[model samples]
Target: MTTPIHVMSEIGKLKTVLLKRPGKEVENLTPEIMERLLFDDIPHLSVIQKEHDAFAQALIDRGVEVLYLEKLSAEAIDAGNYKEKFVERILDESNLETKPVREGLKKYLLSFDTQEMVDVIMAGVRKKDVTIESNHLSDISEEEVYPFFMDPMPNLYFTRDPAAAMGDGLTINHMAFEARNRESLFMEVIMDHHPRFAGQDVSVWRDRNHTSRIEGGDELILNDKVLAIGISQRTSAKAIEDLAIELFDNNSNFEKVLAIKIPNVRAMMHLDTVFTMVDYDKFTIHPGIQKNNGEVDTYILEKGEKPGTVKITHRSDLQEILREALDVPKLTLIPCGGGDAIIAAREQWNDGSNTLAIAPGVVVTYDRNYVSNDLLRRHGIEVIEVASSELSRGRGGPRCMSMPLVREDLPAR
Candidate 1:
């Protein structure tokens, strides 16, 4: 039987993927709370939905099965007969101040059918929208001006962050920020009870229950034997170490973990923001991540002689390290914006380097990064460009918006 989650390589032929179509969650972002919600500006929901549909269709055209996270979450609850359990978990994590408010919110949310309830949670709940007949001073004196009973998850459309698939298992991540922390609950439910995934023997290498943070945006499966994780704003070095130890001790078919450290800044929040694998021996890199000497901090982790320990080696040459990891004699490092400083920064901000590889030499990218797209074509890669005016506002391209569920293994080069 084929595994429900089987992603061993970044450049494999994508068989199935998970995506969240832009919904009211994105529309709920007001200018005041947008930044706090990890969104730059409020996206036009209609336009963003159109663009996202195009993205799903693009994948469908390539023979990739596309699954919607919202639908899957609702289905999982129904399939497992856990609606009450799911709602309770949501309220528990919603940070409702008192038991009275929690119970009131729970009652309000439970009135809807499963799918509507799920969508309402994603869109967030405003205090004004739900009536509570509470005379308690705690509820009466609290700030009424505060917008929501639960904050909207604006980053839900970027399905790559909540969890990531690797080998035959997946990591339901403990996200770095409060804005994204609750997003993984949907993945946990889906993996545990969804009809397509339950009883499938899918492993959870790491769970979202930890305190240390690790995001899927920083996790990249370089090949069957190597993984490249980023130590960046969203992923802590400690999390990388923990994941490495788990994979090594468990025989997860991963032999090496390259912890690539990039500047911990907003624009380059995750490793995939600055780096990604495109083909067997080719990758797209944002020049901003490298020093003047073309150096970047890297730590190679391998199985140690002592059980549960890892052997660590430091390296600064990313190119050489990747070549050795993939076992290719030579490799190509395609710089975002063709290594042009200004264009690189501009395009990289729009996620020019975050290209999703569907097949060996083909990628899905944002059309706004024309220079980067043209350069990729010159490098002998087939580039499929998608509309990004509204989607780009969220600061994620095809790769950031996608989480591959199943991928056909690459033939030997």
Candidate 2:
């Protein structure tokens, strides 16, 4: 039986991918709550959608099949008859004023068809949308003037962070920020209830029930037997340890987990924000991720002598670590913005380093990062540039906006 998910290498030829087109959620960010919503600037909905469509078209033009998260989520709910259960789960997670508010919201949401309900839930339920008769002071009073009954998931456009497809399975993530915590629920529903994957042998390496957070932008499947996870602001070390233990116990082929530590800052919030694999032995790197001497904290995790234990080794030579992991005689680390301090900082903010590799030696990047794009071309890599003037406002690039469900396995040596 063919597995529904098959991603083993970061630079493999992408086959099927999941993407969320910019929706009303893009324009839902208000000045007062934009920061809380994890957006420094709100994108123009029309323009963002145009750019996102162009991005998807580029992928399709390359013989890649693109799927929409919203459509799949709605299908999953309807196929499994999960409308009531879905509403209940959303309400349980939503922090409302009282039971009456919850009941009102549930009823209002249930009134819609599955597709509309999914969109409404993602677009957020504004306070004015629901009417409830509650005697509770909390519900009646104006103590909290928050306009949204449920905050709009503006970051949903970044399909990468919600979940990651590894070898034969995937990890439905528990996001770092509350703003995106519920994002993975959609993927969970898809994997568990969708007709295409309901009974498939898709392994859940690590479910989203844990307290520790892990984001997909920090999870890189280097190869079938090796992975690279970042210990950054969004992904915790404990999460990586637990994932390594789970993988070691279940999957006998997985041999190593490289836990790379980077600065815990918003600019480099994820490993992909500063580092990404572009080719078999080539990678894009933001100079800001390294120290003065080009050292990076990296931990190697493998199976211990005993069951249910992981052996850990700490190393700081990132370049060497990558070379060994990939089994390459030589490695190329292409700096974003051509290693210029000022340009790197400027382009990195727009996710210049976050590139989506569609195939070996071929990647999709933001057209705005001209310096980095030019540098990549000089290194014998084919760069596909897409319109990103509006899309970059989300602080993510092509890689951040896509989640690969299937990638062609690389040829064996």
Candidate 3:
């Protein structure tokens, strides 16, 4: 039996991946609440969908199986005969205040077929969309300013966040923000009930019901035995420790975890935002995450001599650490925007460093970051550029938008 979820390294040849195409959810963003929704600007739905299609096509051209999250959610529910249960769970988390409103909303949602219901959920329900017959003051209150009965999941297109596929398993994340917290539920349902995954032995290294927060954007599979995670705005330190303990005790191939701490700011929200592996000995790094002396806080975790514990070592030199982890004599850190402060800052904001490696020495990137793209070409990397005008508005590049499911193992370097 072939493993359904196997991601041994970041730079391996991509065999399968998961993506969420931009939908009505992008059009649901309004200027007033855009910031709270984690979007700087609203995207033109048609254009964003076109760009997203091109991204999917690029992967398809390279023989990668592209799975859509929205389609999968619907399939899982229908296959498992879980439509009512799914609707109940969704409403339970949507913060629909009153019982009347909740019941009305449930009826409204159930009216749609399974696929349409999933799409409607992603697009969100406006207060005016559902008819509520409540004379209660709370229902008729002066809350006209707020628009949604259910908030739009503007970040759903960034399929990389809700969960991460590790070696033969995955972590259904407890996302950091309320806006994205419910997104992981789709993954949970798919893994637990979908025909393709239900009977599979896909390990849930960490489930989403925990109090501690962790986002998939912060998780990185450096190699079969080494994992790099970010302690950033989205992932708490406690969560990383918890994950480390689980991996160590479960006989997982992962033996060491590098907890790299970056500034917990939105600009560089996750380690992948500022750092990502590109080739066997190459990585793209945004200079903003480093100190003046080129140092960043990093901790090395390994199985402890005592049971139920992990040994930790404080480290600062990222370059040396990478070379050692990958068993290479030398490693190269390619600075985004060619090490220019002004260009790097501007391009980094557009995700110049977040390149998705489909295979060693080959990557997919945003065409808008010309300076970074040109620099990558100069270094002998096969750089495939995709249109980014609408997609960039979401502040994610190829890496942020993709979730690799399976990759061919890299032979010993």
Candidate 4:
């Protein structure tokens, strides 16, 4: 079998996807850390896992290959040298100075399988007494030293935030928050050294100083010829430009890059929050934001023999522009929440617009986004709703639960 290359053309034809099943870290989310971790509330791990499994099954049922990130990361670690480098990087980045804690972390990293490793990394080392060196005039006894705390990575379940697939390779996104930086590092190691993806080129948003930060959710590959990047709260203009330069330098497939600026609102943290493609000529969109009256600005960067040029202007709806520019005949726009003003507003806030397309006319969504589901069904689309009581509390739905790695282009309808 040939090693799979990443080149997504349509959401429906996705052949491979990356997912992280919710774990103890998700359950441990407290109100205190919810906002810090970019969550609205805590969720029960069991329920969330069940829902995620259903979503995964939906994709599998459609013959899509689902690769759990935790599994891949674990297998990558078994490669020996790469594992050591990954561990050292984690230790150095986390700044844990306690000998016992460091030892515990090392042991944990070596002992767990892929699934368990994912859990421990997210749940984190328990708070316990740790030995540390001290240089104080009045020395406190080592026995009385307090336990050093290791904060659980509540946001790790949202794997879409750290790294993104760009063309045939990957881009390791530098995260804005320090609390989640370790997750990014973990993704970087996996994409760079994993056995399944050996010898693949990788891109980094940051330079040696590590100032750049971007997220996969904010990045969208419209086609081999175009990329739709969202400039949102999580992704900066500078980061987009940096990514553009990298793409220009390495990838020869893309001809244009569109920077769609979205409001920095908590609700609209990424472009996928407002728009996502479901089929070759169909899309689910939050018109309120992607339209002219909305808070986003659309710009196009066309590539030539040399590095491309950018053009900015007010324009028609994203769906309209994409349809006209790409010559897609009879593009369909499915509204979230059944197109009812009230329902659309409420459901969209609950991640109604965020559905992951398994294939043409098939998708996964939150059961709680009833209005959106109703709309999808009315459009003759199949809506597979996963339980959301626990999953919804985390402020993400089906789309956030999955990261598509490879998609086959659909023929024009």
Predictions in order: lDDT: 0.93, 0.92, 0.92, 0.70
lDDT of 2 by residue, 123-187 (tens): 98887888777987777564367778888998998999989999999999999999999999999
- Summarize candidate 1's per-residue lDDT along 79-126 as a digit string, tens digits: 999899999998888888887788778889999999999999999988
- What is the C-alpha lDDT profile of model 3 across 1-413, one tens digit per residue? 56889899999999999999998988999999898889999999999999999999999999999999999999999999999999999999998889878887899999999999999999999888887778887775525868888999989999899999999999999999998998999999999888888888999999999999998888999999999999999999999999999999999999999999999899888888899889988999999988888788999999988767999999899889989999998999899999899999988999999999999999999999999989888888999999999999998889989999899999875
Q: Note the residue pairs that clash in candidate 3.
A: none
- Of models 2 and 4, which has the larger TM-score? 2
Model 3 misses residue 179 by how many Å? 0.8
Q: Residue by residue across 102-217, what tens digits does model 4's lDDT show?
A: 66567666665654655576676554423323443222243234322456777766777777766666677778777777777666667566866766443443332358778778
Candidate 4 lDDT (Cα, 0 to 1) = 0.70
lDDT of 3: 0.92
How far residue 52's Cα lies from its native spot in candidate 2, in Å, is 0.3
Stretches off by above 4 angstroms in model 3 are: 140-143
Worst 10 residues of 1 by lDDT: 138-147
- The predictions' CA RMSDs to the true structure, in order, are 1.0, 1.1, 1.0, 3.6
Candidate 4, position 137, lDDT: 26
What TM-score does prediction 4 earn?
0.86
Which regions of candidate 1 deviate over 4 angstroms? 137-144
